[model samples]
Target: MARRGHHVGVNDTDPPLPAGTPLPPDELGHRLTEVFDLVGPLYRRALRKVEQGEAVEGASVGVRSVLDLLCRKGDLTVPQLSRIQALSRQFVQRMVNDAAAHGWVEVLPNPAHQRSSLIRITEEGRTLIATVLDREHSLNREVGGDLTDAEVRACVRVLREMLRTFDHVDVDD
Candidate 1:
């Protein structure tokens, strides 16, 4: 049985390792699996929170993601956004359509690809995404963990390494 706040198959009863404890390469995979287990639920719950906050604006998590990407990366094609987000091109296209309907984003001509138009976040989109991100940041600041910058960086490094390991995996598959 799983303990509260823990996923099944991960033994949460075990005392946590001391800070900076050296983990053997083989054991590291098992520990990282626990991290992955927690990440799924964390992501879902976080998505729900964001969706709830965005209810007033009628933006789903997917649309927010598309808008945020366009805001950060300037303009990009649906295929480019799909690849960057590891989502299907069709799904991304739907998101772009939703954003366009809200006047948050615009479809511009892509000189590089006649078939694929570039998606740009309009001024309205930029403002909405900025507000969303600001709210998220404020919520993030309320996280109870007294985590230091080094600890957060280490967490990011671990997540990045995990992402890189699966970078070659086809999302469509």
Candidate 2:
């Protein structure tokens, strides 16, 4: 059973507003803060869930992220991955190192940059990520809210806007 204040899915805290309701700046800020509050817990919980899975038991979230990026974008330098993922170069390098140790990725000489090597996902890495993603997709299919595409799209828009608002802020590690 879910605990109090730990609702599994969406909670209707505030009533729906009219289609063209004019939101004051303070009200909008408050609403966005509520969204942010939920996002932090949701992300941590999701990471924990992913880590707990047997298929990906040994893969840390950071390592999985690096592998997924390489699988999707082909070989890329550590600096490029860092910039794309908005992570520090040192952190990304550590993740790459971990993946390489696990035989999930390989570092190759980059013709463009003699110093920064290109990171490529191995066949083993592709298989692992595919399994992880397939499991996630199966879990997502359980989200039975009868949600519409338009609603999901609107949610994506709001999240993207929230991200853009903080794009200028720097919290590099």
Best by lDDT: 1
Backbone clashes counted, model 1 = 0
Global lDDT of each candidate: 0.86, 0.82
- lDDT by residue for model 2 over 17-128, one digit each (tens)? 6887755665676667778899999889888878877454477888888988998999999888887777888898999999999999999999988998989999999998
C-alpha TM-score for every candidate: 0.86, 0.82
Candidate 2's TM-score reads: 0.82
Judge candidate 1 at residue 87 and give its lDDT.
94
As for candidate 2, its clashing pairs are none
> Considering every candidate listed, which one attains the maximal TM-score?
1
Candidate 1 stretches greater than 4 Å from native: 1-22
RMSD after CA superposition, every candidate: 4.1, 5.8
Give the RMSD in angstroms, all C-alphas superposed, for model 2. Answer: 5.8
